[model samples]
Structures are given as C-alpha cells and as structure tokens.
Target: MDVDFGGADDILFERSGHAGIVTLNRPAALNAVNHRMVRALTRALAAWEADAAVRLVVIRAEGRAFSAGGDILDIYEAGRAGDPPFDFFADEYRLNAAIARFPKPYVALINGIVMGGGVGVSFHGSHRVMTGNAVFAMPEVGIGFFPDVGGSHFLSRLPGGFGLYLALTGNRIRHGDACAFGLATHSVPADDLPALLRRLCETGDADASLAVDARAVAAETEDAVMDAIARHFAHDTLDGVLGSLAADGGEWANAMHATLMARSPTSLRVTFRQIRTGATLTMDDCMRMEFRILSRMLVGHDFYEGIRAAIIDKKSTPHWRPAALDAVAQADVDAYFAPPAGGDLSLQ
Candidate 1:
C-alpha cells in the first residue's frame, strides 16, 4: 500500500491493488473534519481519479464515528477573530460539490456516526454503505445554522416530508431509518464490510459488481420503521409536529419532542425553508442558496454564540436572539435565503 501527503496524519490514504482507500484518521474527535483534512481529501480523490491503476475509491473513517462533523471549533475561532466566515464555507462546499460530481466510482463506507458535513462527503458517493452502527443526522439547526455542504440537495430529495422533518428537528436516523429514507444504499453488518470491500476489489469489474452486491446487502437489512418515521415527520410546523407527537403519548414521541426543544428555533425556521427551497433546486442552485444563508449567519446572527455555549463553554444552553420561533419574522428568515451582496456561489 502506498501513502501520500504526509502532512495530514489526521487523514490516512493508501492503495490496495486497484482500490484507493481514504480514512478519516482523527478517532479522538470521532474523525471530525478540519480544513487540512478537507484539502488533503480533495487532493487525494483528484489524484486517484486521474490514476490509471486506481479503479475505485473507498472513503471510510477510523473509530466509532465516521465523522462527528466539520470542525465547528475552527468556525468559532474565525467568527471570534472577525474574519469573513464565508471563506471556510466556500472552500468546504466546493470540495463537497466536487465529490458529488466526481467522475469515477466513489464508495463511502458509512460505518458509524455520519452527520452534517460528514454526510456531505459520504452520502453523495456512487456506493453508500451503512452498517448496523451507523447513525445519521443534519444537526446544523442545533448550532444556530442552516444545514450546508450540499445538504440542501440530498435532504430535499428524501421521500414525503422526511426532509423538512429532519432539517428542523436535527433528528438522528439510525441504520434502519437511514436505509428507509434513501440516505444509504446498502446496510450490512459492521463485520461484513471488510470482506465486502476486499471482494469488490478482486471482482475485476469494479463498477458493475460493486453496485450489484452493495444494493443487495442494503436491501437484505431493510428497515421496517419507515411507517413510524412517515407518521411522525409528516407535519409542517414544529408546534404541529410536537402536538401530533404529544397526542400520540408514546415514549418515542416524548424523546423526539425533547430533541426538537433542545435545538435553536430560529435555525429550525431557516432550515425548513432551506430544505423546501432546495428540493426544487439543482446542485449548483442548492450550493448557492446555502452559501448565501451561511454568509449572512457569519456576520449578523448568533452562530458564534451558539458555538460558544454548546462547544466552547460546554454549557449546552444557547440564548438565541428572538428566542421564540414566533418572534422570528418572515422578513428575517427571508434575509438569510436572499442573495448576498456579491452573488451566488461559483465554481471558479
């Protein structure tokens, strides 16, 4: 196995015959992604795509979590320094878009926690494999920001109202629910993954055989909990959703209500709008919209405060401005979705 780019010890890259495997190497942080890791990953993928000997690329992570998410601590530091936060988002988003549209066969072995920016890298792959341990979500709303990193595109594509439900609630989808929501292609036992990867590599016909086996494995572990998800997540507003759940009076409903109450109200409204708007948008359009919202959040909103309280202060309490959901006016939410002074996100 050959390894390149020694600077990013947090990201491990190696080649096994015709297969290229990229592992997120930060186990202590649950493989959370930082700027250096993102840059290294982008470079590695580009190199593998160009290499004649590399027939496939596998993106997996070390530790119990695939990735906790993007390095929010870095974002907090940039915000505190009064730096234009758009720079980080722009670079990260560009990397995600590249992966979504990458030409070669991309396989994301989603073995554990895959959330927020984690989903951005792993979900768009041609072959997305999940294990019994995988837990997925877009918890950006909890941090007083709308979901980004192409979240608008993929979450919007979810069936029924599941997209909007997740955007606002920061709901955690387990391995079964992930398959039911179309967030993952295959669901195999965690133990089966290593052998599956080896088999796919040795199959010679990398593209066709991998796809066939991956789909079969996923179908075999199909989630029967889709009805419950659909029933709980179909409501339009947060209050309505809660009311419906409360009326049911089940333990699951109580747990879900607690989850929703813990997140930022303003973020929920903005995220709801983001997913709805994104549902009708192209990949470029989704990125552009998210970029606009995130740019504004950097300068004008309580994103810094949210990060400070939850991560820096370790308080778990975020005092959001216009704290109540009803206090957040339509105009205020509209401003986040509106175009920035410059324009939409551009590839160049």
Candidate 2:
C-alpha cells in the first residue's frame, strides 16, 4: 500500500509494505525543512503511529544531502520583517519531541549532508543509518545559533566530551568519525543501501537489516582523537577550554583555538551552557531549553548578521555584536535560558 498527502512537495509520505516511508523531496533546497514540511511530517508520523499496518517508519531524502538544516532563509526574512516565526520553532520542537517519544521503530537513512535541522530530525530516531558518503555537523554556532532541535539532549550525551567539541567547532565529520563517536548505528556502503532499504521494507526489522561496518583502523585513530577532545573540552567554562587548548601548543590545538575565536561569541557561551545544562535534564526538558534559547536568538542581532554574511551575501565574515567572548555578559547569556513571554514549548 502507498499513501500520498499532497501539499508543497517539499516532502513526500508514503506507506510501503510494513514500513511507512518519508522522503525529503526538495533536493534543490537540499531538503531544508520549512514550516510546511514540519507540519506534514508531524501529521504523517501521528497517522502512522495509529495504523496497525505500519509497523515501522523509514526516513530518507532525495539528492546527495539528507538535509542541510532548517529553512533559515524563510526564518531570516520573517525576522527581518519583524514577525519572528515562533510557531515554526514551536511546532518543530514538538515534532522533535514526538519523534523521541515515538513507540515504533524510526529509521533514518542518512547518506549525505546532515547538519543542524537535519540532525534534529534524524538523530532523534531509533535507527540512524549512515552511508559511506555521509557528512554530519552541528554548525549552528557558526550561524550565531546554538545547537537546537534537542541538541541539548543528544549532543550532551555523546561520550568523552566529543559532543561539546562538536558544538563549539561545528566541524563536518565523515562516516568513520560518526561511527567512532557512536552517532551512527549502522554504516552501509552506498552500493548496499538499496538492498538494505529493500530488506528493511520487507522485514521491518531494523536490527536484522543493519550491519556494523566501522573500520578498525579508523576507530583506533578516532579513539586517540577522542582522548584529545576529552582533555581539551573537559573544562566547565569556554575560557577554561580555550586555555587548555592554548597550553597544548599543538597544530590541532592551534586550529581549534582559531575556529572557536571565529564563532559568534554569544553563541559560543550560550552553547556551552546549553550543553552543560542539558546533561542534567530529560529530553523534553532539553527541548524546552532549546525553545527558550530560540526565543532569544530570533530577536537578537547576531543571528541575522550571521545569515547576511553566510547565506545572503556569501561574505563569510559576520560582524557579531559584543564581538568577543569576554564582552558577552553572563546576565545576557542567563536571559536566553529563561522562559519566553508567550510561554515554554508545550509538548504533546
């Protein structure tokens, strides 16, 4: 059986065999999730959850990228026009929570670029399948945003301080690294993906269809790197982390120090707090925390400035307000975690 709920065509939903299938369509947009796509996906997942015929759900995307993230251009325009799109974030956050709480097996087939919003959708699911070509990153700090979309939950939980390292640096990682870090449950070759999909659809058994393909040499090397990451990022404060990196006097340390220096100062500090606080909270609480941050970020100066430089103008040189980490006040960072006037995100 197959089902199609038509709308903007940015996403497609269908039922195949025992698996409910979701294909991120809008390849030209790199499957960047917009408000419409979020609502559609939420509705589809809800419907499938109640349908006994649908034993599991499989999410994949068109084109070379799984998803680059959310539709920041839409967000940018809306915010610039003075109407912050709060509903979008609310609905999206609810969807993220719903996915996290979903009873059925949720399999995400990630073969290409997966970043901020992309991470929100796939990483929350039960099965995160990465192909050889997969590339993953958080990258939100670079855009003057913290890693939202339950990043506070999952990123905080990644072992050996790797999640904190990823949040601050926003570095793109490949299959080997993702596997080494436990971000990916299964690593499949591109050529084998089709067969894997077929088997999944036929059997609806995620564990049975999946096979671990992490390279021993790569995992061995990554273990060493994780040790370095754990050491440098072990500090409670951003300043302490930077000091650790500086004292090392190594090439990698120098590059990491420079990368952190380039990110928006406000974003860096807020993310540090977000990751730290998230470690102690539940997934739902983490989503609420991200909502609080989003409320502040959408109204702040740096997010727009970041969009202008990185996306609109392509200059890649955002002049962030407060410019340096020391200039970002503790009080201001504290405000981001506070509840919004409208209210906190109420998840169903």
Candidate 3:
C-alpha cells in the first residue's frame, strides 16, 4: 500500500503478499533523496518491521538510477541560509543506522547510479542485488564532503586497501567490480531482475527464497582486478596513491590518475583521513565522526562551491580552496574528525 506524507511523493511504499517494497520515486533527479524521502522511508520501515505479515523488505527506485545521492540542492540551500549542515546529516545518519540494524530482512535492488546516500540506504541490506548496468561509488570526496551514511563502516571493511583507494579517488565501480569489492551480494543480468523479483514476491518463505550461497556467489563474481586495487590503493596519502598508479604505466593506471586529478584536493585529503580514522571505528563512532565533519561543512567549507561548480553550475571545474592535495594541512584534516564542541552524536 502507498503512504502519503504531505503532498511530496518522495517515497512510495507498497506490500504484495509477504513482501514489502519501498521505492525511491524521484525519477527526474535520478531518485536523488531529499529530507522527505528519508523520513518517509524510516517510517515505512518501522511499520513493515512491526508488521508480522511482512517477511521481506525490497528497496528499489523508479528511475534509471537507483539514486544519484542525497539532495545536494537542499544541502546547498542550507549552506546558503547559514544553517548547520549537520542538521541534515544527523537525520540522514539516523535513518541509515535504522536500516543497517533493522530486524527484518532488507534487500536493495541496485539498478543504476547508486552512490553516496544511495549507498547508505541500499548497501546495508541483507541482500544487495545489482544489475549489469549498476554503477556504484562513494564519491562524496569529489563534492568536498566525506563519505557519510556508514560509508566509514563499509569502506573500512573492504578487503586490503580498497577502502582507502575508493574514498580518495571517487572511482566508479561497475556491477562486476561491485560484487568483487563486497559492495553487492549478487549480480544478475538487468533484464532478469523483474522475473527474479517477481519470484521472490511469489515465494511463501520469503527469507529462504531470497537466500543464496554466499560463498558460491562471492567465488563466482569476485573481481580479479581487486589485486590491482589493493596494490595501488595501499598508499597512505592521495599523492602516494597517484604516484603508485602513475608508476604502473598502464591504461587503467593512467585513466585512474586522470579521474583522481579531476576531484577537489581538499575533499580528497579529508576523505583519506575519513577512511583511515573509520578503519578502527565502530559504526556508532563513524556516524558520530561523519556528523561532526558534516556540521562543519554546513557552516562554510567548500561543499557549496563544489556542488555549485559540478552539479548546479555544471562547470565541471571546481576551484578548490587548496587547489592541490599537498596544500591541505594535516591539522586541518584532523580538525574535521574532531568531536563537535558539545559531545558525540546522541543516538536518541
């Protein structure tokens, strides 16, 4: 059944037999999440979790992209109005945590362009299924923000140094790479998804029907290219990572270098520290850290400018504050991760 929150159709929730489905409905902006969607989703999930009739929760989107990300336009407006950026982040993180620890089985159908907040909602699922066209990344660094929404938790868990690499470079991973990188559980052809989902809905034992041999799935789809990801992404700093890639002297290495070079240097540095610090953090600590950084960003970091240049203005050339990775100071990066003046995030 569909639920309405005011006039905004930000989220659509429906139930079919034992299956409860949540759809991100903002197709025009690639289903990019805004505040209303987050709140509606949280409410819907709470309802479904309490409903014994609902055995499974499937999250999908109505657009070509699963979700482009959190609504930067809202963030931009907040920054413009001089409101605390943490306000949005705190609420969003709460929703993210709810999804992560939700009692019922939650599945995410990652069809296309899953990134940033999309990852927050979809990646924590009990079963994350991707289509061949699905593209995934935590490219917050490109926009002068750290990967929030429990990215710290998952990014740190990525095998070897993959977490550090993706955090710094904002590289996009295809469905095959996503499965190999542990970001997704299954990779079925995009065309087969409708039937698979239909079968899932039709099953009497939804949980058992959705379950697949995790080991077999991993072995079959593990990305062979991850060795390169581990080796090249092992460096502590972006400079070192780039140098390693450059030294490798291959088409992939060259392409990766160009991609990294295009992102904001300040963002890259902050992202590096975010991943490193997040490596040892519990999920709670990571969320708290992200809140602190995001709060600071709302006041007047480069996030507004980055979004203006990249998304709104569509210039694609962001004039970062430091303009180069080496220009960002260690102390500045440390400050971003520091706790807010009062205390850590309040779970309640």
Candidate maximizing lDDT: 2
In model 1, which runs have C-alpha deviations exceeding 4 angstroms? 5-7, 204-258
What would the per-residue lDDT of candidate 2 be over residues 1-348, giving only the tens digit for each residue? 656655368888877778999999989999899888898889888899999988899999999999999999999999999999999999999999999999999999998999888888898999888887889999999889889999899989888888999999998888777777788877777777778778878888888777533233155345666778999999989999999999999888899999999999999999999999999999999999999999999999999998899999996799999898889999999999999998888998
lDDT of each: 0.78, 0.89, 0.78
Candidate 3 TM-score versus the reference: 0.89
Go through the candidates in order and give the clash count of each: 2, 0, 1
**All candidates: TM-score:** 0.88, 0.96, 0.89
lDDT of 3 at 291: 85
**Greater-TM-score candidate between 1 and 2:** 2
Better of 1 and 3 by TM-score: 3
Residue 23, candidate 2: alpha-carbon lDDT: 90
lDDT of 3 by residue, 72-166 (tens): 99888777886755656777898888888888778888888999988988988778888877888888877777788898889988887878777
- Alpha-carbon runs more than 4 Å astray in model 3: 4-7, 204-207, 211-225, 249-251
Q: Which tens-of-lDDT digit does each residue in 20-57 have in candidate 1? A: 88888889998888878877887887788899888888
Candidate 1 pairs with clashing backbones: 186-218, 187-218
Model 3 lDDT-worst window of ten: 212-221
